[model samples]
Target: MMNRILLSVSGVLLLLVGTATLLQPHAFFATEGITLGNDPGLLSEIRAPGGLLIGCAIAILLGAFRQSMTQTPLILSAIVYGSFGLSRLLSMGLDGLPSSSLIAAAVVELAIGGLCVVFLLRLKPV
Candidate 1:
């Protein structure tokens, strides 16, 4: 169904991004034109959220195959994507514009989050 497809796609994206961040923080950030210096504490801080994002991705992926567990993941998807997208927008306002790639990422995040909201609304009460 559409929900499964959405979750699957979203989960995979989160998984890949999280994995890349956790395993290759410098390389990952470089894509966004961020030059991370050799600071252990900073690297640690940056890597921490990668694990959390991976956890969210796992939960979202679970909902794709589990009929009884769709609702929670839908909510998670909306929260995760919505927050990321909104935060990026806020940064754009406060810190000024970033790279075009980052702007595109924000748009994608918002679109996915919006889809999750739509799917959540369509769910029947249990």
Candidate 2:
């Protein structure tokens, strides 16, 4: 269930973002569909990773919550995604207004991370 959720969400996000960046880097930057690191060189480097990252994220999500699969990915998502969300929450202090995309991104990330965190934290040792 959780795996499906992540795969559906992330898979779509990855494919859309990857294609968007590829088709028009300037347009994406203009509308803030994606934001790269501050420096142009850094942004270029960052862009390089997006291509396969989204696909990988989808795969990981599917693996994490398989009915009888390993727990490591779930554990990782709780930490990594949750921290990304926590950072977004903190970013609210940085500016009074953030872009709509950022807000939406933050919301989704928090949802994914929050679910992972709650489930993982609630687990008990056998």
Indicate which candidate wins on TM-score: 1
Scored against the true structure, residue 98 in model 2 reaches a CA lDDT of 77
Q: What is the Å distance of residue 36 in model 1 from its true position?
A: 0.7
Query: Which residue pairs does candidate 1 place in steric collision?
Result: none
The C-alpha lDDT values of all candidates are 0.96, 0.62
Clashing pairs in 2: none
Quote model 1's TM-score: 0.98
**Residue-wise lDDT of candidate 2 within 52-93, one digit each (tens)?**
555555555565457454355566556556776778878887
lDDT of 1: 0.96
